[model samples]
Target: MDEWFRSWGLLRDERQRTVFRRTDHTHLAAVCWPSCDADTLYDLARLAAVLMARDHEIDTAPPEQSISMARAFRSEVSARYGLGGGTGADPRWTPVFSELWHSLSTRRSPRFMDRCLATAPTEFLTGCLVYRRRSGNATEADELTAYFSTRRVTVAQRIDHLLAEASLGIELDDEVLGDPLMSRLLDLDVDRTILIQDILSAPRELAAGESENIVAVLSAALGCTTPRALEEATVLYENLTDTYEQALTALLGSPSGRDHDVRAFASALNDFSTGLIEWTSHSVRYTQAETSNWTKPDEIVARGR
Candidate 1:
């Protein structure tokens, strides 16, 4: 392993001995590359850990300190890439490494930060750390739990606020959580939800008149659907919206409303919901138990395209 990996405690040998649990989808990495060697995967894992730690640090840091630290990190990364005055390192790293670093380092841009935090490394790391606490080294796990608990809750609240603003929020109360079908909805990544919303909102901006094509590309990019949703993709999204809203209303013990566009955001996330379920079932970002009970529908038809 390289010094960076060792310094971050992501060494492959060490990981093998420990219960290195992880459950967040590195969507960018999956979309960009088909596969990688063990070393590359370990590097990505380590980088993920570091990025997640930095996320908590930035979120809890005072505004001035956060901004300053973000700029400094950005500058440091840019310098390594020869953007600022400094000698650049060898360009031997995999493309995923570079992409992940760019996403993690773009703290100055809220849009970029939103995208990163949407499927942030911290989310996955938090899941893993919690899993470890329940299954593996307690003392080590407690340290991680203590360090990240407050930060995780803070970030989650921020995300909840964003979801509310977007009208995509649902009360994750005992009633909702107790329902097996409803609770899985919480797994929906806020970043992906926003991306889907943006694409569905202004499809032409992304693909001119080929909104369906763009949706297919997005579905493929997200690893949500295979054989592409194609001509039926638009109809699928619409069906998803209506059905999702209905499901949400039922779960929330509320009635559906006429202003469907802004209420509960259930419809806006039909594609995302479907894709997340499909993707998470097989993705390494979730545990087998989490997906074991998932029942795939025999058919996924939408209204006539």
Candidate 2:
């Protein structure tokens, strides 16, 4: 696993190396079977690399280059696994992929979604497939194929949504999983995040329309009048916005700032101090949007490209 990742140029430095070591579950029987063979371990490593690539946010090769590289990877893994036949005969096309596939495909599991959102692009897609599979009852293989078949634009949009949630630095409490106020709070935070992105990404000063949008977003999000109304919602949005601004500023002002930016943001957000607004956007358990019927899973599959 380590060797293969190194070949992919994945473990570039001590930090990445440390993360690899930390996440490596080869020794854990629950993650890897007690008698799992080296071949299976290598396959798992490849799958992990595919899933976790987005977390690193490495610039990947273009499609043709990526396809060529993936082909080479498949050949190498197949050779090692002693399934040297080409194309459909390759071992990866077999049920061997299903074993790991089932494990990676999570349902409405918030923890699993959180982990997926925190991962890199490839893994994020894998996470989405898991969601579609578990929630919509689609086959993992079909969804995986459909995902790649879709246009890069759709995939890019999906990644953007996942990245937003991953950067939000919050999670939800099970007790308030179905609370409408909590959902509204999350929706507000999400809108705030979108507005923040729009403001930061713009080249010129905020337009009158954009300015109005900000005020509207803030008005909807920040409960300006009463700190008492939804106390948890109020405080949670405050800390979340604080973290968001600091992280955004740090990224824009100094790209090479300290390594603890995310930690600092999380600390400021203080989710642990109170579990009120700990919900993340990826939590199927929580509704982070004003309207959940924008698109259906099958529709995404049909016109995803």
Candidate 3:
């Protein structure tokens, strides 16, 4: 471990070095590789090594073991940070957990995945901190009472930070948390029914030529007539469009029709869009193009010759 720390030290940013030396599992998880922080560190190390090789005129093999150690350290950090203390009865935390699960299951981008993986530590630490702060006078029977409280501002701030990190193209281990919109939604209080309703009413952009495919798929799965499937498909399509529009409106200031139940609307739209992508793929077509016999059959018109 000492040797490993020394190797990490050689790449020294003082904060990073401190993060390494303290061996705080939460901090380690926050900066682990493939996560944005890790990717940043990796790039910095590579650049430093390049300069050293060029200027110092020294030949050095890449520190493969050190890289591996960093990853291992990150894993340990996540485990420690995510334990969430001994109590598991926080009602406030329940919705957060649900959002986390939803983000994990729905979003599939590589960037999103990395963020999700990286979030283990942050979520765990935050949950524990909230629990400790709010659950001071809890009794056995009252264990079911709300033991966690998160201000909307704090949640929003964290979500913004994560989104900024993701937007900068930082590689994260879990793609779900890396998804900009999903991350934003997860930060909100799920009990805010009005917010939820608004989110679902937003518009989405179907990937090129994906609407037809999605329609066909739903038609098969629901075992409905083509007309009925088409109607349902249109509804689904509009919902998906609304989701993207809403997300874009929220994140990028695109205009959207105001929604009454923003949060549920957003959550439902996100969920459906996510499901549509998972169900439709490049290979899901119902028909294949017949191969053409363009090779000039045998002697290519000996009659013409």
Candidate 4:
């Protein structure tokens, strides 16, 4: 069992190296085991998690003890398929098994785990078929093939259900992930450019309104309310405008900047300016908007009348 596991480990390392270099799926079919079903894939993932846990000192078990358990697990899987003891003899089979094992061991991110769970049964069954074939047990190949055909149909149905759920926005979460500012910036469409500009010039807009309270809010959000903050934002806006003008000048005078490119630059500048305007407009609104009433409503009404 020890020797079989060591051989499997070596095969996994080699397979990972080969798969890592390939850019397309052409090699995927070639590398997958004939009997590698989805269950086998799940088992492989579990094994990997166990190994990682042991390695990270999250699991208190000895290394040799873990290895023995892994060996036993592999043997049980082989026996369940009626393929009997130890690793198969085929060179190709070893590498395929190794690759699957290595992928499970290393890539433990949520996305990778989701993929592993989804495809494990098919991979394991296919791997088992491959193992049986390599062991010269061709008689059971037809049975394995029939089983895989049904499993494939089931998998296809499940995938369709998942797709429908995704399309319905069932998977969408309000919680922000990644860098919020960068994500917001990346998500900026032409229609949302004004909002972006407003965010960028918020401090300046608030200060211009003489709203010290609003200015403080903007300062807290931006992390720095230095005069340079407003100056830098103003300069960025001016630079963007100048870039557009420069392109236009070059297009008309020297035939240096392409007209089409200049048009795009102008459009971008318009977007920036529009955003700034929207932000400043909001600041003005907030400044003018009533937040408190020191005077009674009746007294103000009588004065107005």
Candidate 5:
């Protein structure tokens, strides 16, 4: 872990390192990766470390610079094996990806490995960059949610699809990939783990000039007032929560869910969502302002710029 951290001055900023140590993702990881074998956990940690660093790079950088990096990223990653640095990529992080590429060469199917290890992260980091760029300007809730799906595909693919096999680790062929129930479980995990943050932090986020909040995006999209958006976002959050519970129940009842390995995998994924909910509810990160009623997500008020 220390070696990977040193691969590219990752967490080099003392302030960032401090924040990384206590990052909410770490809490989420604690829930998901606890039972993974050493190697699997190691692989996940390395990938996440780089992704998180890259995500934070944009977060901490000036807006123009982040936009520049986002625009330059496609060209930069296209030449991952090139010897020289391109426009936006850090040369040092190249080696990090290079190392992972080599390690993943045998562990996963070549194409799946390529997309998950290479294409998915690029897509996800690109989405994050675009997110920062459009944070305050987004008017389409569907588009915002699409970007949110990138995170789900990236993280869940690592754990469920890649490591857990077709049905969260039951090892069915590619056929199971089309399972709608599985897709629902995956999406529920995503909104549960990611989107809820937007609703809970709407106040602080709006004050900071970021409109990434679900409420803000819905407000703009629905052409409604801020309070109405908040109410709707709360309703949406509740829907997401309810859907998560139902999907998880169905996951546990499916044939794949009958497998011991799949059960554990699904359970870990569920724990991650629940853990994040508990953490977000109490962590100073979102509690900077008084929060809405936990039992009633609809009660949360929205803040505006």
Candidate 6:
């Protein structure tokens, strides 16, 4: 992974290299993208970097400059990739993107890529089929699940895993395990994650003067104190977890062959959801980086256990 960044010109210097190393994306990718082979991970890492360049607000640049940079980046990326029309992106992107685009086009046709870019672009770019979005912010849980599934991840490796394990056909392209019961299982899987992330990242986000978090949002919506909000959120997490386990139990206890494919897919999804919780619990991505010296990757990065 570090070699990819180094050779692709993404992490050009020692500081950037150090930061990339400490980020420890490899662990998370391995966990969440449970079905990814070496080639798939390579694609995921490369495209994830491109996506984060303008999407993730990592820099403390002034709002205006940041917006300007994002617009230029989007435009440049669109123009270069032929996603749509735009001009005058950062010149540095040209070489890196050209190589990426070349390799991508060699594997897949431009028209197919355009279609991929049009829908669930992140899944295609990242080459992971574990479908999710951090969109559990809703007054009700079921509503959030249905709403979020509309914009689900649509990559292919999860398909690969399912096909390999359950011997499923391409007819089941949709990632919901194709039923309401399976849908609820996934909703619970993601729901606890948002709650956990809300609790964990709330400190850093509050320090940065942000409150688009479950703890803060729930506090405001429920008219409760912060402690009450945290408590309620923890209860909700436990409840969701219990229900999800029950759902898994119900599925796994079936007589035989009733929902085998869905069960197999659910296992992979469990790996993804639970793996994310473990990885983030160990990583400092959501935590304040002040305590640890990030210059040392081994000290800071939460390696796979």
Q: Give the per-residue lDDT digits (tens) of candidate 3, residues 1-305.
A: 32332443343366534433333222212222112344443332332222222211111223343333333333433532233442223332323333333343343454454444456334533443343333233321111112113322212233333433442443233343345655554443221221222222111211222221333334456776546755765664466456645554674331222322333234333332232222111111111212111212233223112
Candidate 6 residue pairs in clash (backbone atoms < 3 Å): none
Q: Is 3 or 5 the stronger prediction by lDDT?
A: 5
The numbered model that scores best in TM-score is 5
Note each model's CA RMSD in angstroms.
Answer: 18.1, 19.3, 21.3, 26.7, 7.4, 8.0
lDDT of 4 by residue, 1-305 (tens): 22333444432465433322221121111121112245443443333323322222311234354344334433433432122334543333334444444554353444433433334323433443333332333222123234333333322222222222222212212231133431332222221232233344455446564221222333344567555445544554456445545544544343322334333432333333342243233332223322211333344334322
Off by over 4 Å in 1: 1-95, 100-109, 112-120, 137-247, 250-265, 276-299, 303-305
Compared with the true structure, all predictions reach lDDT values of 0.38, 0.35, 0.33, 0.33, 0.57, 0.51
- Give TM per candidate: 0.27, 0.24, 0.22, 0.19, 0.68, 0.61
Query: Which lDDT value does model 5 have at 186?
Result: 68
List candidate 4 segments past 4 Å from native. Answer: 1-201, 204-225, 248-279, 282-305
Which run of 10 residues does model 4 get worst, by summed lDDT?
Answer: 25-34
Which candidate tops lDDT?
Answer: 5
Q: What is the alpha-carbon lDDT of model 3 when measured against the actual structure?
A: 0.33
> Candidate 5, residues 31-78: lDDT per residue as tens digits?
335455556566666665666666557666776777776555545566
Give the residue spans of candidate 3 off by over 4 A. Answer: 1-168, 171-223, 253-305
Candidate 6 per-residue C-alpha lDDT over 213-277 given as tens digits, one digit per residue, 9 for 90 to 100:
66666666677887897787788778877887897787666542155555556666665655556
Report the lDDT of model 5 for residue 17.
62
Worst 10-residue stretch by lDDT in candidate 1? 27-36
| Model 2 lDDT, full chain set | 0.35
For model 2, where is the 10-residue window of minimal lDDT?
274-283
lDDT of 4 at 262: 31
